[model samples]
Each structure stands twice: as C-alpha cells, then as structure tokens.
Target: MSDATAPQPFNKEIPTDEEGKFRGYAKARADFLHVRLVVAACGALIIYIPHSWHFALITVIAVCLAEALDTISLNQSIKRLNSGAPLRPELRFSLYTAAFQALLFSGVVIGGAILQPRVTIDMFLICYLFAAVMNAGMLLYFNSAATYLRLLIYGITMILIISMRWMYFAGAPVLAYETAATLLLAYIAFRVIDFVENNFREQEQDKVNALSRQKSMKTQLEVYANKERHLLQLAAVAKHANDSVIVFDKTGRITWVNDAFTEITEYPRDEAIGRRAGTILNGPMTSPETVAKIEHAAATHSPLRIEIQYYTKSGDPIWVETNLVPLPSSPEMDGGMIAIERNITNSKLRQSELANAMRNAERSERAKSEFLATTSHEIRTPMNSIVGLTDLLSEHDLDPAAREYVVALQDSAQSLVRIVNDILDLSKLEAGKLKITPSVFEPGHFFNKLDNLMRPRAEAKGLSLSIDLPDDLPLLYADEGRIRQILVNLIDNAIKFTRSGGVTVAVQGARIANTCRFSVDVTDSGIGISESGMRRLFGYYAQAEDTTSQKYGGTGLGLAISRHLAREMGGDLTAVSHEGQGSCFSLFLPIACTDQSLEGIEEVTQIPEAPTANLAERTILVAEDNATNRMLMSKFLEKCGAEIVFAEDGQQAVDLFCAKQPDLILMDMQMPIFDGVEATSRIRALDAPQPYIVALTANAQKDDRDRCLKSGMDDFLTKPVRKVELLDTIYKVLADRPMMEKPLS
Candidate 1:
C-alpha cells in the first residue's frame, strides 16, 4: 500500500452516524500525516549524530513504510464501513499494525542509546516520541482497539529504556534521578493520550444521538401532512355525493346532513340538524315495523340495511334503500350513526307493473281455452246428428241422384270436422298445453296403416300413391298418435292438390350417437309454391296464394301446427319447391334409438274390421241428452242386431245401470243433471257386476278426455263419432264384458 495508490474517500453522502464517525477518523489521520512525518524525520536526524547514519537511514525508511501501511488500512476501513460490512477484523488488524509501528520507533530510540554509550537518554528523542503518541491518540481514538494498543506498546518501551539506563550507567551521579524524571514525563504523556481519546469518543456519541432525533421529527411531520390531506378529500366527497348521507348521535338527534339529504327529502339541513331522523324522513307510507328495526340497530350500535317507502314534503311516495353504520367512539365526542340512502321509486313501480302484466296474460290464456272447448262442443253436437242421419239414409238403398247429394253432404261435414280439429290443436300448441305420450312402435306397421288410410282417397282423385320405406328401419320411440296425425295431413295435402301425377312418400333414417334422425318426404306432382310463399308458409292462417284457399278449401293451419309439434319434439319441418315444378314437404325428427333387435315383432298390416255380426244379443245402455243423438244410437244399434235401452241424462243412466245391469253403458259427458263423469263414478260405486263404461261425447278437449277416464270410464271417444268407430268400440267391449257375469233372466 503506497501513498499514491491508497484509496481516498468515495464522496458518497451517507447520512447515517456510523459512516460519519468513520469518515471523521479517516480525515483526522490524513490531516496529521505531515506532522507525523516531520516528527519522525527530526528523531532520525538527532540519532544520526550519536549513532551511525546507516542505522538511522534504515530505521527512518522502515518507519515511513509502516506509516504508509497504516494510512492505507485506515482508508480501507472507511470504505468497508460505507459498504455496510463488519469492521471487527479490520480494526484488529489495524491495532496489530499500529503496535508494530510503535515498536519500530521504540527500537530506533533504544538502539541509538545502546550503540552510542557516550550519550545518555536524549530530550529531543523524548519530545519526538511524545509528539508521535499524541498524533496517534487523536487520529485513531474512534477505534478503541488501535488507540489502547498504541498506549501499551509505548509504555513497555519507556520502562525498558529506563531499566537499560539504570543498569548500564551505574557510575553516573544523577542517572537514577534522570531516569525518575523520564518515567514521570512518560506517565504524564500516557494520561494526556487517554484523556484525548475519551473526550473524542464522547463528542462522536453526541453527534449520533442528535442525528436520530432529527430523523424521528421529519417522519412525524410527514404523517401529519398525510392525515390533513385525507380529511379534506373526505369532506369534499361527502358534500358532493348523490346518495343522501347523514350523521346522528347515539340519542338519535341529527348532528349533520349532506346536500343530497336535503335534495332527496325536501328538508333544509338547518332544520334537520337537531331533530330526530325518523320525524323528518318517515311519513304516512313508512311502515312502523321498518322504523322499529332502524331503532333497534341504533340502540345496539349495529349495522343495518333496509328498503322503506317514504313520502316527500309534497306528499309523493318514494322508495329508499338505506345503509347505516355505527361510528367509532372517541374522547372528544360520543359514538354516532351514519346512514347512506339511495332513491329507488322507479324500480318499485316497474316491479308492480310487471306483476300485473303477468296476471293479465294468464287470465287471457284461460279464457281462450274455455272458448275453444265450448265452441267445439256446440258445433259437434249438431254435426253429430247430421253425420249419423246421413249414414242411416245412405244404407236405405236410395236412388243414385239422392245418393250423390248425400255423398256431397257427408264430405262437407267431414271437412268441417277437420277444420275444427286443426283450430283446437293450434290453440293447444300456442298455449303450451299439448302433451306428448311416447310409445315404441314398428315403423313399417305405422306407414302401412297410413297407406291403407290414404289409398282410397288417392285412387278417387286418379293419382298414383307410392310409399318407399327403408328395409332396416328401427322401431321408433315417439308419440305415435301425433306423428300419425302429422303424416296424415301431409299425405292428404299431397292427394288433394295432385290432378294426374303420383304422390311419393319416402322415409329415410340413420342412427347417430344416441338419436335416430329420420326424415319423411311427402312429394307431390301438383302445383308448386312460389318463392315468396315459402317465406310465409309456416305462419298461422297463411297460404301460398289467395286463390289457393278458395280453390283448395283448407284452413291453412296444418303446416303451422305440424311445425310447432315438430319443434316441441326437438325436430323441425321444412320444404323445397319451385313455382312451375312440384314441391317436397320434408318432416325431420330426432327420436331416441336403441340397439334392441326388430327380428320377431309382428306387424299389423291389415286394418281390423268391426265384427258387427258378433254384436248380436248384446244389450247396451245408451245415455244421451239430445233427442236426435238418442234416436240415431237406437236405430244404429238395432240394425246391428243388438238390444238397446236409452237414458236421457247421466242420473238416469246410473239408475238404469243398477236395474238392468247391462253389459255396457255408452255414457255422454256434458249432459244435464250431473254429467257422465259423475254417472260413471256412481256406477262404479255399485257392487253389481260392474259393466264396462265408455265416454261418448262432443267435448273433445284433452282435459275432457282425462276427466272421463279419471272417473272410471274404460274408454273415451269424441264426436261426431263415425259409424265404424262407434261399432268397433262396442265390439271390443263386448268381448271383455262377458268376464262380468250377468244375472240369468
């Protein structure tokens, strides 16, 4: 470590006390460097005259080198302290080096005395040693290790010098006295070094204590400024907020109110300040229960949130949502409550309006259902008499002219029946009351039945009808009856429009994942729909052209109802057509498919005939209110070789059932004096042989059928009942009726 290469101060502004002390010590050493050099140089010169110059030169050079090493160590120690490194090891090393430098000076002095025996202990050497010790005590006083070690080294050297002089110069007169003065002077120098070191340490400690107090005061001032800024911001926000805010004491007397509070309640802040909150805000509309809840929360110092209706100064109703919280207690003031309220008058009005609208919609739907049911019964009752009388008239072997008129009458009646049914179905679908009953049936059997039904109509129109079915068709899971109705509509439309060419019905199906996706395409060679018609074809009461309804004579509800039913079954209905070409109406449906084999399930391809020949000797009890329907039933049953007894209403039917114990009762619902449902219930209550009861009525709504079956009727059939259907129903019941034993005549 040379003088030129030694590190200087880093010029970093370290505000801490430890760094300040280290820098001060380092500066002291640097400032006294010239003094130390001059003292050592003078000592070396004094020794030069007494001893050999070579010995003095060697000793001075060694001392200069030791001083340079000590200066380098001091600079390095300051650098380490600034970097936040521990200095215990550096301090210990510095003490060892300083002791070494002291020992070198002591050696120089002792060697000069021993080599030049003619000269005794010199005063110049004593002054030089004392100057060196004083410089070291000032420079290194901050480090106790280095300062104490320097004192110990010099004290031992002084004792050794005294002992050497006392023994070697025994013949001298006051040599002993001179040694005592030397020892006393040495003791005074050591004490002065100790006092300078102690005083310097005390001054450095006071500076450190003062720095800590200054830092603490600066921190406290910053905290106070932040608090003042926060309080100002809170005051501004409260004054401008849109929600009403108020503060009140524990006794419920208002302390303060915001601008918004005055705007919402139409009460001035000055008047509200000292009054209880409830008296100013609560009005005739405010519920006592809600006020009680607010009081309870304030009494307990708890939080509360509620919605209450209030009236303004102008007597207009307002709904408010309030949130209240208890303020923390303090020495300057008792704890208080703070509340924030928002106006919600518009929200409350909207909620009430929505409830009223829903109720009106429900009432309208119920009225529509009742109207459809009543209209169906009224229309079908007269149509039933017309249809029944026409059938009886046709069987009498009438003339050809008369027969043609009867045929036209029957076709018109059937068309009217179809129209009524379509309207009922559409209403049920629109009202969301249609129910689907799923059953497993063979696709082949279902299509075969459709073919048998539509073939006769197609042949009459001189159009060829063909059906194409897949060879590996799976058994379908769906509402078999509804699907049949949809297919019937499609095929009937096809037959009605075609003049010359054929109608082709093709069914294609595939199993994908868990569903069977199938399409039924009913294509006809009749007039096709225009492009404009396709857009509105599925809408209610719509047709392709205005003249089509007049020429074709349809209600135009079939397609709309079919599409609604298709979507309800999780499928859709669509069509493709051209104006001059034919149209293909495709019905696509997805039904649940299974891996169950269809190997041995029998298909009923032939339509069952009513076994009218086997109906002979069967006694039937007919319950009917209409005089014409009674006559028609009697005549029809008598023609079939069966005995019939008639009752005018439901109660009479029950009385006849107990007396006659007939094999079956054809019960009519909606009759006078307790309907068929009640009559059936009474008949079932009787312990007599329990004859089969069938509901035969013009009330064709689904609910009507459910009511009849629920009252213990074995079967239900709606009017105007066809001859074939009525005969078939009775034929089936007769076979089951024999199981109920009839008493012998």
Candidate 2:
C-alpha cells in the first residue's frame, strides 16, 4: 500500500496521526485478505446451497468488488502520507458509511450461504468455522470491524439457519454449541492483539529518537575540528618567537616548548618533552639553589622573574633572565608556570670587569700611602739630629765663620722637614684618614700671630708685609690649626716667589644663612701664573711650572693639600692670576659663626725652658733604635744637665729602666725587639714611681697620641721634633710628676 517515497522498512516512530494512517493501511490489506477468505468459503459451501449456486457466486463477486474499492481508497491515502505529499483527511480512508455498508453486504452474503437448503449439520459447522478462523488475522491487523463483528454476523446467520432446520438440529444441539464456541475464540484473539500492539508502538518510538541524537552528535564533531585548526595557527607564531618559551606540568615536567627553546638550549622538542625542566638545563654552572627555588615556586603556585645560570646541551655556561608565569588553565599542562628566558652573559661579563678595576685601584692607592708614610718616618729620624745639632752649634761660643755655617745648615734641615711634612699630609688625604677638628677662635689675635711670624722673613726679602683684619668678622668655628697651616703655606709661597713686590694677608667676611663666609686672601705682587698653569695648580704634585718646584724650593704638594683641607672644612680654595701680575689665592671657609668675645681667653706667654735633669740627681733612658736620633737626644739632654742612658730597642730600654730606675724615659714607638707600648707597660708595672714616659714617634695623628696615653705614657710628641717644642713638652711633663720634684723646680 506504500508509494515509492514510503519507508521500505516501516518507520517505527510514527506520530499519532501517522500511526492511525498506518493502521488504516493495514486494515485495507486485511480487508483484501478477508474478502478472498469469504469468497473461497462461498464456493466451498455451494454443495450445501443446492439451487443457490448462481446466487452464491453472484453474492461473492459483489462482496469482492466492494472490498476492492475500499482497499484501493485506503492504500492511496497511505501512499500520499508516506510520500510527504498533501493527503486530504476525506481521501485517507473510505467513508465510514461505505466501509460499514460493505461489511453489511458481506454479512448478508455469509448468512445466505449458511441458510440455503440441503446444508447438513456437518456442512454448516465447517463453513462457519472456516470463516471465523480466517477473520482472526483481521482482528490482529486492524483496530475495527474484523474479529467480533464478522463472528457475530456468522453466528447469528447460523442460528437462523439452525431454526429453519429445526427438525434436523433439534436432536443435535452439539452443532449449535460448536458454533458458539468458535465466536468465543475470535473474541479472545482480539484482546491479545490489542495488548501487544501498545508495546510495539513504544519500541518503535525509541529507535527513532536514537537516530535523531546520532545526527546531532555528527554536527558537533565538525565544529570541534574547526577550533583545532585555529589552535594550530597559534602554534606557528610561538614556534619562531625570539625568546625561549617552555611550559611545565604541575610535577615540573616539560609538556610543551617552542622552536626557539630548542635553538637556545641546544635540545630538540622530542628530547626535551617529558623531561624535568630543571634537570635538563641544570649543569655544573647552574646552582642547586636556583633549581630548588624553581621547584618551590611550582609547589606553591607562584610566579618568578629573576636571573639564573643555565647551560646548553653541550654544557656551555650562560646567564638567563628567567620569567615564570603560572599556567592557570591549559589543555596540555596542569596548573604550572611557563618560563621565558633571555641570554645576559655579555652583561655579566661587563659587571665583572668593573668590579675588578675598582679593587685594583684601591690596592694601588693603599700601596702609595704606605710607601709615603715609611719614607717620611725614616727621613724624620735623621732630620731631627741635623736640626738639633745645628741649633746647638749656633748657641755655643764659636767663631763668626763657624756660627755662620751652623745657621745656614739649620735652614737647610728645616726646609727638608717642611718637604717631608707636606708628603705625609698628602698621603693622609689620599688614604682618607686625616682628621679635622673645628673650634672657635678670635680672628684678630690669630692674624696677629701669623703677621709676627711672617714679617721678619718678608723684611729680610726687602718686601713689605701687610695684614688686613675686618672689624665685623665673627668668631670662626673651624679647624684653627689647619687654617693656620694653610695661611702659613700661602704666605710663605708668596714670600718665596716674590723678588721685589710685597705680600698682603687680607681677611674678609660675609654672612650666609646660619653661617659666615670667611675669605682669607694672600695676594702677592710677584711671579704670577699663566692661564695654562692655573688648570693643574691644585692637582697632586702640581706646580705653576716644571721649574717652579726646583727654583722656588718646594715639594709642590702644599697647594694640593691646602685645597683638599679647605673643601673638607665645607669651603674651597681657588686662585685668580695674570701673567707677570700678582696671584690672589683665596682661602674660603664656611664657618659656623658665633658673636663671642675674646676677653677671657688666656695665652701661654711664659718663655719655655728645656727640662734639666741634674747629673748627680737624675738618670734618663732614651729608647731610640736610630743611632743619630739617640746621639742627638743625648747631647741635648747633657746640655740640660741630665745624665743620659741609652738603649737600642724596646727590650733594652725595659732592662735599663729596671736596673737604673731612671727619673724619666723617652720612648720611641717603632723599634725591632719590642715595640714601645709593651716596654712602657713593663716599666709602669715596677714597684716604683711611674716616671714621666714620653712617646716620641713619627705617627702624627690624634688617634696615635691617644694610643700612647692609654699605654701609660705621660706625654706624646711627633718626630722631626722642633728644639723648642720638644723642650717645652719635657719641661711640662717633669714639672707635673711628683717622682721628679727636684728636676721640676
């Protein structure tokens, strides 16, 4: 009944309307089979029909034609519906009236066959029984007018036939009962078909739903494939990036890497993947601490941007700035970091070079300072004797010619001492160990003292000396002693370089916020500097000209030392000069000022007399390693009326002091056998009066003086000792000690 477009295998998941149409199609099929069954029974029953053969044949032909028409109508409707063509509801099945009329005619025809005369009891039962059996299929195949209605028509017709043959069937009631039993069997079959048909419909629906889901899944797979293609494009970009990129899994294994990673690390992608990132790159140069740090970051899920050492596959060391970023979501890797590295080996090399240069420069500077200090100390020891002997010779009753030679010799020794002192000062500045102490001083009185010192030298040179002190000048808080040194150097240079013109000492002042600017200008009207000469004027060992140091008699360090000292005191020293004209060297000091007067300040005015150790009363130990210095001190002390005892080293000094119990000990700090400090401690430990022990060494620092005092010394003095200054210190020490009462008076 299905057309060409119909499902060859019946579509199981039919809609409610489609199921009705399908069942109607089945009914049309059953109607055709049922009509054939009835027609065959009609022929078979002809023997019982006797004279109604012609009537029976005509009745069967009429029933076949009617059923054929109704089947044709149902089949055409099903064909249109299955083909997805328009199917009118009116045309889908035969009019219900036509269907019922066909059934009525079939029933009439069946009744005629059963009721005809000459039908025996056996004949009636077989025809009726065959009709009921054939209709059984109709009950299962169609929902309407098949099993019960057909059986009722047959049963009622037989009962009427049985009444007509009452005389034949009256005694044989078994035939009637058999007929009733056949109708009952047909009703049972109807219920069975109806029950089974519901289960069949549900199974058919499940199959259709499964096919629909399969079609949808196929579409989804296509979309996923397109997304996979896009990801491949992103991978191409990563493959050629300059920086090395690698991804790690949560367990620290490499899951993916770009082509640049392989290029920089000298390992291929296949070899790198599945390997621990740290283990693969961690060679001898790579620190274990770095690996542990990376592992810790992974464990804690942290990000890192730092530099670390890495090695190539061939074991060449290099530096890298590694950047680790956490991969919160990635299909290939679990939660982990992606490390990007850039090479920085060149930068590391440059930094290493700079550090080496700095260390070398420091070492060279230290060596220079040490050499200068040693040379100064060695020269001072001998220089002390020459100056002292010359002074002694000058004081004696000598001839005029001998006295004149002694005075010239004294000048030479003093000049040598100044040069050595300048070298030591320069070294101290370079070593960053020079100490400056600021104090308040009366500018007018300080200038008066400087004037008196320089006036005689200027007068001898036939040059005028002038001092200009400003009345409004405030008391200056500065290193007064260093200031005096600078002023003296400038004034002395002015006097030494000038042949005819005068030297002027000018002091000027100005008020700055919370401070005063004091400019002391030593302007000399002689031998001026040229433009090129001023450029290197304040540099180490620099002079106005090459011949300036030789001709003017200087070590060429005074100006350099002066400049550094001025800056150290929060000021500067600068020069302004013109060729053949006078040079003005300005000493600028930013003073922490005060308005205090100098009324109460007392000056030491008493003439200083050298200490006298009465020969019969006092014994003094002189611990000096140098023979010249020892002889010089002995002659000076002998002149002072003191008996002299000599020791070559600290150990001998201790022995001599213990045995002789000297009234005083003059200790030299640096000696071979035992240093002065140890010898002084041993001498002070004796059960006797701690005689005044004076430290005389070449170390001219305040810290050195403190060290001597802490070691039980009574007084401290520097080497290249001036005759007057040395005598002054000894007299002061002896006068203060109770152990030397007679010597003090």
Report clash pairs, candidate 2.
none
Q: What is the per-residue lDDT of model 1 for residues 338-383, given as tens digits with 9 covering 90 to 100?
A: 9988988888889899889889888987888888888998899889
* TM-score to true structure, per model: 0.68, 0.60
Predictions: Cα RMSD each:
8.5, 22.3
lDDT of prediction 1: 0.78
Residue 98, candidate 2: Cα error in Å is 81
After superposing candidate 2, which stretches have Cα over 4 Å from the reference?
1-245, 258-260, 284-286, 302-309, 319-333, 340-359, 398-404, 470-474, 510-516, 595-600, 603-619, 639-643, 660-664, 677-692, 701-715, 740-745
Q: Kindly give the stretch of ten consecutive residues in candidate 1 with the minimal lDDT sum.
A: 1-10
lDDT of 2 at 429: 80
Candidate 2 global TM-score: 0.60
